[model samples]
Structures are given as structure tokens and as C-alpha cells.
Target: MSFGAHRPMSVLTWLATPVLFTASVLGLIGLGGMLLDADWRVALSSALFGPAAAVTVLLAGFVEWRTVRCRWCLGLGYPAVVFVAGLLLGDVTLSSPVALALGIPALTVLGVLMRRERNRVIPIA
Candidate 1:
């Protein structure tokens, strides 16, 4: 009756993490740029991208949440906190595609780590 014990994630779910993480990172970059210049038009345009990013991150989180029993969502959480910190500090242009590129590999590594750490977390069946 424990959480994440009833079902584990598929290999495809693990593989999708990088893709989801990358999309979210890109969306955050767009969001950051829009917030920086006080351009309402840009802000509006970028704001529209936020939900998709949030959803992608959330799906990645859900995969870990339901299978690994570790808060992979927190992986998504750190960048969000940093982004908010940047926005609040008026460092909007700090966004970088390179940083986003790094996130894809990081999430891939995380996925592999999770799979290695707990076989139960990954549904081979």
C-alpha cells in the first residue's frame, strides 16, 4: 500500500526524460527573455509557452513519482527556483541555451541512475 509501489515506469518513460527536460528548459529560456525587457508582447508570447513546459516537467516528475519513489520533480524544481530568483533579481537575460543543453544530459543521467539504484522502479515486465 505504499506510494509508487503498485506500478513502475517503462523504459520508454525513462528515455523520455531528456526530451521533456529539454523542452522545459527551452520554455524557461523563452520565459526569462520575455520577463527581462518588460515587453508585454514578448512576455505574453513567452507566457503562453509556460504551461507546456510545466506540463513536460510535471510528466517527468510523475514518472519518477509513481515509479522511483524519489522526488524527481525536485530535479525540475531547482531550475524553477533559480529562474524565479533571476527574474526577481532582474537578471532575465541570464538565460542560456548551453545551460539548457546541459539539462538534457543531466536528466538522462538521472534516469539511468534511478534505474540502476532500484530495479523495482523500472518495470521490465
Candidate 2:
């Protein structure tokens, strides 16, 4: 129940799933709009959100599979997968300066957390 009790990396991995899933779905809708109207704005919107979703879901699934928590995995996995698929195949782009800025910090945090967790799990032998 407490934040400190749970592994930070695992918790973040789980959290990212829903966020990515939502972004993917929204991106898809935006892509659809672009397709219907041939507008760059719609396409750009879709591209931006879609990849964000995919990354989140991917991280979540990776965590779930690694940790073997079915409930959490299922809760996070399906949406993330769907979003990723949409991003790849849907009429959306996945590149942005803002995304690059945000991704670096997010990835760094995850790496740090994972490293800390790994240290905790290893024996000092």
C-alpha cells in the first residue's frame, strides 16, 4: 500500500501502460481525421500521441512479463499492444522535439530506478 514498499521501477512500468494506451487510441482517432481530410495538423496530432502511447504500453508489458503478475500484466498489456500496433500502422507520425525532451528524462528515471532495484536484489557476496 505504501510507495516505498513497492519497487519503483515495477510501479512505474505498470503505470506507463494505461498512459500509453490512452495516447495510442487518441492518436489513432487523430490519424483517422487526417486521412479523411488530408490535413497535416490531424496527422501531426496522431503521430505525436500514438508513439507516446506505444512506448508506455511497451514498458508496461515488459515489466509485467518480467515480473509475472497476470492481473497487472493484463491490465496494462492489451491496451499497450493495441496502441503500439496503431502507431505503427495507423496514419500517424511518431517524432517530435517535445517527445524527445520528455523521453530522455523519463528513461533516465526508469534506468535509475531499475539500477537501484537491481542492487537491492543482488547479494553482496
Which candidate number would show the highest TM-score if scored against the true structure? 2
Specify the poorest-scoring 10-residue window by lDDT in model 2.
38-47
- Candidate 1 regions off by >4 Å? 1-6, 38-125
For residues 1-125, what per-residue lDDT tens digits would candidate 1 score against the true structure?
45655444444554444445444455455456544743332122233334434544555543535334344545466436534533453422333444345445655666675666466544466
lDDT tens string, model 2, 7-125? 33455555554444444444445545544654333333435545555565555533524445764766466555655655665564443333334445555555665566666552344
Q: Runs in model 2 with CA error above 4 Å?
A: 1-76, 79-85, 94-96, 121-125
Q: How many Å off is the CA of 48 in candidate 2?
A: 12
Worst 10 residues of 1 by lDDT: 39-48
- Compute each candidate's TM-score over C-alphas: 0.29, 0.35
lDDT of 1: 0.46
